[model samples]
Target: MPTRPSLDSIALMRQWLLLLVLAVIAGQVLRLIGMPAADFLGSMLVAIGLGVRGARIRVPALAFKFGQGCIGLLVARSLSAETLASIAHDWPVMLLATAITVVMSLLVALFLVRYGDLPGSAAAWGLSPGAASAMVALAEDHGADSRVVATMQYVRVVCVVLIGAVVSHALGSDVTPPQIPTGTAPLGFTVPANGILTILVLTGSVLIGARFPAGALLVPLLAGSAMQLGGVFIIDLPQWLLCLAYGALGCYVGLRFDRATFDFVVRRLPSMLFSALALIALCALSALFIANLLGKDFLSVYLATSPGGLDSMAIIALDTQADVGLVLAMQTMRLFGVVLIGPYLARQIIRLSR
Candidate 1:
């Protein structure tokens, strides 16, 4: 549906301008409420609302791909050598937590497939305990309804963020996000040389993965991770750039929704909500046992295992004074694990369910 675009520049700007204005308003309100991935979710919800009401604008494909690449780099920032060392040191526990998460996600997927009549790939990827945006992109690559997957993933993200905040509060800590000094150069110090290099890495990775399945996201993630682990350079995406990426991605998923997809989501809203809640509860129980076994602080282990977006969990971890490194390490582990095996597991779960 070129419901798409044309060569007329003024017309194109006219179409996008209204959506952008609304998105900014929604995003700011959501951010003030401590909502997770506020920019992405606000834009997405606004787009979805417009789509259902017959809006006709869509994000260009190139823009969306760039957004995906930036998300990959954002994730890559977490994978430092020290983080890897901590993960390797606690390999058994880390693996146990990852395995439990994968298995539980599949079971939730199976339930949705068998009972809710949802597509298997979307269900599995939706429940996966990883970065929500990355999982949404991967689900799209592998033939799932990205609209459904995005909705499910965000639903669980909301659940995880709310519960994580409550747990952090109960444990005697404020749940406000950790603050960064304004206008500070990325990576916490001035490194304009490496900042330029980081941009090249992001750009090259995006171009390279443009044609590969989920490559736009995965390539930058792997490349950025390797670069960081080797001390070559830290990834240096500023908050404004990341907000732009999230906004593009949000619009892309949102504007593609048709009346039929909208109807399906509305009809299945209860099951989606139930599935998200059940998944969070199960992960929390597992985290309790694992924390005791590893003799780590419960809040630290719980946030690590929670199936929320990395940024949200990271905020909670920093605010709560939890072990930030371990939190990031486990989150990154589950994230990569989901990217590698989530699709295959979706197929297997579908087969077993039948």
Candidate 2:
């Protein structure tokens, strides 16, 4: 006969089941409200609550790697010939905006290091406007508190999403958000050859890059982007699959927050909020200058210059009918810029802080 399940094992199963159901509900609710990264936020919130209440759960290391890989592919899907051409057409303006944005983020990180309780590495990684999950992984490699880095990143994400929408609407994109869902839509409702190939590509890339810092995300991202832009293969992923990846990554981060780490964040929450708003304001000001120089619409320029929130920015640009291509080109450039320069910059900030 098979061995009997222990009481602890059965209870753990129940906890996991509850976590799944609640996470999906929370994610959908947030999504309906136009929150960026709803799935990640939803699952994280649920996991944090459960963790604080004495629930024992953990995401596997492999699961975390896979989650990072999915995010890489998500970012990669936006890479296309059109996006590249847009950048080439506006290379000067694009380069200026990207440089200024990176500087602004670093300045904010420097402020946090000088005055806030966070260490320099944590502040730098947390304040970086690149992909939130990718930043957190890099933070881990650099000896920052991953929990603190995560809080800083997602907090900024929330602020950026809300402000981006309000600005787009104020500048006269659709006065109301469109009912359509945002970002790279899945190839179809069904999985096809492209989807399978994409999955294989993601898995293989992650495995290949597994030994490096943020290799899982960085490798797949670069590889998938090149292949997609070169017309090597169409990158397709089902909605359910991406959701699973998002949830896995969120839960892994959230569940790892012990009571002490959570308390540390709560005490510093106000500082984090201030930094987020400041970054958005600074970026908005830059957008105004860039728009005047290029003779473009203010809304389109703002969306392009908005720090982070690539998907949310895309949604706002499309729904409000802003210059969708320009916004994507600028945002994608910043995404890659921060990803490439982030590690070196974070180290420099840490050194300067000391």
Candidate 3:
């Protein structure tokens, strides 16, 4: 015999169900309208509205990690030998562009602290273009304001997606909605063999990556790239699985912004918005210089340097048929760089703000 759930528990379960239904509905609606990152943006909007309405819903922690793992596999499967070769050939430019982007982010954080009245530590983490969930978690650990950090990170994501869409539309880029995989494998082993190997590598990496910060995503990505480049196998994830991954990620992010979180930083939203736009503009200018130096097109450079999540940037690159390899290489390099040095820099900024 099982014990009965309490009233509070039952209420929480209901809230979770309601959240899921609304998120899916919103995501489908957004997809139908041809929006970039439709699942994420739509679910996020619904979650935000519900959160602001005083609903007590929370996304399970494992849900986020699972979503990250799926995205990791998707990106890893994309890495080809050509992509790696391009990064190697343009090593100097990649390093310089990544370094410049990080420095620019720091400068914007400083501006937020001095002029926008945000705390230095929070501003530092908030302005970072690393994975938003990771940044928010790290900010909380470093005694920064997690609420503000989350707000800044998501605000930038929304802006980046919308702006990227508009730019792609204006330039007559791909701008197609993300869909399930629908391509054939190159001349290689049987389909089942390749699929098994891909799943093994993806699962193994996520398990091993559990010990590292944001390792669940990063590890699989690296492992997948290595396997693909080595010609050991290929990855072609199914379409339905990709959709589920997108939904999970979007819903996870959406559920995090509850009413109290928003109210805490409501007054500073305008400043945060301005600071985010300024940072983006500065990064775009830097991309132009790098593009000219390397003879690469401006769109690739801009997307590579744009301050957004690695997953989001990869999606935009795929949609626009931009240099997916270069964008991934640049974004992956920066993600590692920031994860390594961001905490120390946050500490420095906090001291400077004193």
Candidate 4:
């Protein structure tokens, strides 16, 4: 026999479900309105509005965190030795890009801190080129105000998503309503049981260590790639899982923008906007140069250059029918590479600036 849910608990659950539904509906509506990136931006707006207005919107923080944990697990299945080998071959280039991006981020952050009158930790976490959640958590750990960090990180994410969508649209891509994936593998493909088991194990590992914030995203990516390279496990996560991961991430991002943060963000709107555009431009130029040297198409290089979150970029790649696997592999490689070396680059920049 199972215990029944208390009335309060049931009410809370219902409220959470309603928020998720509303988020999805809002996201779709925005996409239909030719503002597909509005899903993410909308969430940020909602979160900031709530914070500012002192609205008691009960967000399902645990659910959002769990959803993020699943992203790496789902992505892990796509890793294999061939992909690993390719990443290894391009490791130097990827590291170089990561180094350059981190340096650029730090320089921008320092400028924002000194010239823009922002807190150092807030600026540092705000500009770090990982997921918004990772930056916020790190900022909190480092004693920055959580609200400010959350605002800055999500604002940047929204900018990246919007800019990406606009760039896609400008290139003559259709800006139509987004559709959820139907759970179907490509023709002649069947998921294996062993692959399923591997994903579960990897996911378990991530959850057990998720207290480390970005560790959940980073660990599985590295471990999964290693396991695949060693031929220890083949991964083939379900399409539904990937869709859920994307939706959850988007929803969480949307809900992060409460009212107080919005006002704060609005106050520094010009500087923040300039910083984001500058970073995007710098990354794009770097990618273009690298792509020219490698003889790759500009779009592929642009995706590689963009400092968006890995999961978001992967989703965009899938939607556009771009090389999803290559995008994921390259983005994952660069994320970990940057996270590992970002602080050192920041230190160097700090030294040079001083």
Candidate 5:
């Protein structure tokens, strides 16, 4: 006779399954609510509240880390030699914009530190443009509080996503979809062996070098791009996987919020908010200048300038029916470029200020 499954075991399995389902559903619901940017932030908020109340809710660290890694891989795929050529052709404008953006971010950080009364480390983390995971990692490396940096970076992401959407809508240019070529085929599930191998190699290299965070973002990106441009593979990471990753990331971020961290954030909230807005304005102005110089439309310039997720911004480009290709290309280019050069820039800023 076969034994029936224990009631307790069955219940546990059910609960686990339910949690996964809810997380995926939550991501879609958040996106539909026009606050998709808050998917992770919202999850974290819930986790923090549970923790504060003494509930034992634990987020799996590996899952969260892997999810971050996937984002890196996807972003890396957006790079190409052709994109590099375009950047080089417009080298002066690109360099000018990049330089100005970095300077503005640093200025905001300094202001927050000196006048906003925030700690130097907190200010530095808060002013880091996009690349939230990387900023948090760098903060930890430099002996800064990871929790504070995470909070500030995520907060800025939320702000940028919201503001970017609103700005696009107001400009009367938000009705177009992404302009990137969809290639010759309809979007479908088609994975290539070479793509997988490339991911493995890139990821492995990053891990060996002790740059896991960089590897996570860059590996998938590089692999995907190679497959995409070589006409051998297509970028087709499952949406469910992405949602799962986002949920895990959200849970991890939220769980970091304890009473002490929350209190600190509250105290520095005003300054953080001001700095975020100032940085956005700086980017927007810089975008306008680049637009004039490059003879491109203002919308393209605006998105390229705005600091947000490459995927999220790409989605926005698609939603607004804009040049999705160019938008993705620029976002991808800037992300890797920034990640590669972030340390150097941080050092330069510290040196120049000193």
Candidate 6:
């Protein structure tokens, strides 16, 4: 007879089974109700609840990156030649709008420093629209309080997603069904050549992306775009795969909110919520100008300008049938801009505080 499984193995198995069941139930219920980012929102809530209950649930980093890569490919498929031309012509406006976002983020960070009593550097990194994990990882190295920075970064994420969904529903934008491209082959089917190229591009880009900040998402995106634009390949990913990606990404984010962390931030929750709302408002106002300048819809521009994660914004764009290309372009530009200059600006903020 086989030896009984170790306790750790048994515990791990139980955790996986629990998460899988909850994610599926939550995902199906949300999907039926026509919710935006249903898979993500549902799985995230489940994970968060599990964490609060003291279950050891975690979505690996590779899982998050895989989800990002899938999204990058999906967004790339939407970028045809005509859309690329539109993006090229509007590059200047996009650049300006991105610059404005960075400035706005810095201003908000400064406010947090002065009014919230957070360390200058921590406030800056926390409020920056760059990657939360990246910011938190770098914050300590730069003398920022990692705990505060993490708290601030994740609080903003939770607020952005919840408020964004409400805003979309309020505006009547979330009612639209997922708009798959008309000319695409049936779901679950892909041409072999297209599939091979798609796999190669995604795998290669992800490998290279490991070396660059936000590269897991951005690099795959660039690769997918190049492949599609160059006439090298056009693959319509299966809906199931997309759903899996969404779930993976959602779980990755949701599982991070453990009970201890949640408890620690409870007293300060109000300020965090207020700060998140304030930043979103400022970004929305800026979006109005960008929308006017670019002649796009206010909703699309607002989502693009919203200081949330790129993956989150992409999901919103896809959900609302917004111009995914423009949202991706604007968000990507701002991401790179912030990553490049955010450190220097953080230093300046620290100096000023001193």
Maximum-TM-score candidate: 6
**C-alpha displacement of 109 in model 1, angstroms?**
3.2
Write one digit per residue (lDDT tens) for candidate 4, span 33-80: 555344554444544433344444544665565555555554555555
lDDT of each: 0.75, 0.75, 0.76, 0.62, 0.61, 0.79
| TM-score, every prediction | 0.72, 0.71, 0.87, 0.75, 0.70, 0.90
Model 5 RMSD to the real structure?
7.7
Stretches off by above 4 angstroms in model 3 are 1-18, 177-188
Better of 1 and 6 by TM-score: 6
Q: Write the per-residue lDDT of candidate 2 for residues 1-354, one digit (tens) a residue.
A: 886333234488898998899999998886676554567768877887776565677888788888777767766665567766766887898889989999998999899888787889889899888767678877888788897888888678757765775565455444332332233324332335677678899899989977765577668878888877766666776778777887897687667655666677689978888888888899989988999877888888887888765655654564565676687668767877887888899999999999
Provide C-alpha RMSD values for all models, in order.
5.9, 7.0, 5.2, 7.1, 7.7, 5.2
- 164-256 in candidate 3: lDDT tens per residue? 656655666655644433333455666777777767776788788866777877888888777766666777566666666676766666666
Candidate 1 residue runs with Cα over 4 Å from true position: 1-12, 34-36, 75-79, 118-190, 210-214, 228-231, 294-303, 308-328, 335-348
Q: Which stretches of candidate 5 lie over 4 Å from their true place?
A: 1-61, 68-88, 145-147, 168-210, 309-354
lDDT of 5 by residue, 1-354 (tens): 985332233454554454455555655565564442345544544555544443334576566656655554444445456765676687677656666676788788777666776667666755766567777887788776787778788667757766876776677653531122223322332345434544564456345423455455455555556556666544444445555555676676555655566677788778777888888888899888888998878877777777765645654554565544456556656666666666665565455444
> In candidate 6, what are the lDDT values of residues 1-354, reduced to their tens digit?
886332233477798788878998997887787677878888888887776666675788887887888888888877878888899999999998888888887777777777776778877888888777777877877788888888888888877777777677677875554444423233333476566667778778877886777788888998888767766556556677788888898888877777677887786676667777889999899988999999999888888888888888888788877889899989888888877787898998888767
Q: How well does candidate 6 score on lDDT at residue 47?
A: 81
Ranking by TM-score: 6, 3, 4, 1, 2, 5
Which residue pairs of candidate 1 clash? none
| Candidate 6 error regions (>4 Å) | 1-10, 174-190
